[model samples]
Target: MSETIYERLGGEDAIAAVVDRFYERLLEDDRVAHFFEDVDMRRQRAHQTQFLSSVAGGPVEYSGEDMQSAHDHLDITPSDFDVIATHLAETLVEFEVEEADRAAVMEAVAGYEDDVVTVAAD
Candidate 1:
């Protein structure tokens, strides 16, 4: 059997690093950083790690709220989602993950777009 993306991504520890960097980038970006203004980053990082781990086919189980319900209150727009996705993709690149593996991870996360971007584009 082919190696899972999680294995290819160096498992849980690596994913944690990715999440850390991703959040750093997110917080630095003024366009979307406000969404995290009141958020507890430590817990958010853990939740994100589990989410990406699941998306990467890892053994981690995501017990956080579902994407739609979790994000519904945030009124996330499509552009905000795209910016976050870009941050994630760039994070993967910075980590030197292979293109195909990055694509797979993005694809998995993209599936939740509808569930996440509740606010329509302007």
Candidate 2:
């Protein structure tokens, strides 16, 4: 069988780097930066790394709250989800991940859109 995205992306270390850059870009963007104003980024980043590693089929297990429960009170809109997804895609590209691998990763994240997005689109 082919390698998993986690293996292809260089496992936990690379995933950690990607998560850091993804959150950095998200925090810098005007559209989504406000959502993180009160968040504990260090913990968030750690959770995100575990989550992404899990998604990518790594050995890491995500011990954080479920997506729906995590975002239940965040009031996240579809646009917010899109922006975050875009940042993720860009960060993957920045790390020179292959297109197919990036698409697979994005698809994995998109699977949780309904759970993460609490608000309807306009």
Candidate 3:
């Protein structure tokens, strides 16, 4: 087996940083702000960090609800998901992540699409 992509992302601290900044951007982003309007950003950020860390194969364990259950009532659209993916990609670039590793992160996110964002087409 190869080193998990999470290790390449610098483990928990790195994943935490990435998630923090990603949420910050999302909060300020007009395109995505509505989704979080009723959320407690502090808790949301923490959950996101744990989720990303787990997804990246880090040692941290995430105990939050599954993606579908977490976002099921939100009525998220493909455009909303697109906005999120863009922010994630931009955040990774801002952190100077390598193209290959960034691609890995994007690929990992794809696995959650069906769960996180349920579109009519899906």
Candidate 4:
């Protein structure tokens, strides 16, 4: 059997490191920084780490709010989502994640777009 993405990603410790670097990139980007202005980054990082761990098929279960509810108030644009995705891809590259694994991760993340990106009410 093939190794799960979590195992391929080097498990929890590596996921945590990736989350840290990913957040750093997000915070540095003007396009997405505003979304995190009032967020408690420590908690945010924890949630993200757990979330990704689950997505990567780790044993962790994410207990955070559902993606739609969690992001509903953020008024996130598709462009914002794209920027965030780019940061994630870049972070994975920085961590030297293999192209196939990175593609898998990005594909998994893309699956959440409908739930994460909220459109303004007309």
Q: For every model shown, what is its TM-score relative to the native structure?
A: 0.98, 0.96, 0.89, 0.95
TM match of model 2 to true structure? 0.96
Worst 10 residues of 2 by lDDT: 26-35
Model 4, position 44, has a per-residue lDDT of 99
Which model is ahead, 3 or 4, in terms of lDDT? Answer: 4
Maximum-TM-score candidate: 1
lDDT (Cα, 0-100) at 76 in candidate 2: 93
lDDT of 4 at 109: 96
How should the candidates be ordered by TM-score, best one leading? 1, 2, 4, 3
lDDT of 1 by residue, 1-122 (tens): 99899999999999999999999999999999999999999999999999999989999889999988999999899999999999999999999999999999999999999999989895
Model 4: per-residue lDDT, tens digit, 15-87?
A: 9999999999999998789999999999999999999999999999999999999999999988889999999
Q: Rate the local accuracy (lDDT) of all candidates.
A: 0.95, 0.94, 0.86, 0.94
Candidate 4's displacement at residue 72, Å, is 0.3
Please state the error at residue 118 of candidate 3 in Å: 2.8
Q: How far is candidate 2 from the true structure (C-alpha RMSD, Å)?
A: 0.9
- Give residue 10's lDDT in candidate 3 (0 to 100): 84
lDDT of 3 at 81: 93
Which is the better candidate, 2 or 3, if ranked by TM-score? 2
Q: Which stretches of candidate 1 lie over 4 Å from their true place?
A: none
User: How big is the positional error of residue 68 in model 3, measured in Å on the Cα after superposition?
Assistant: 0.7
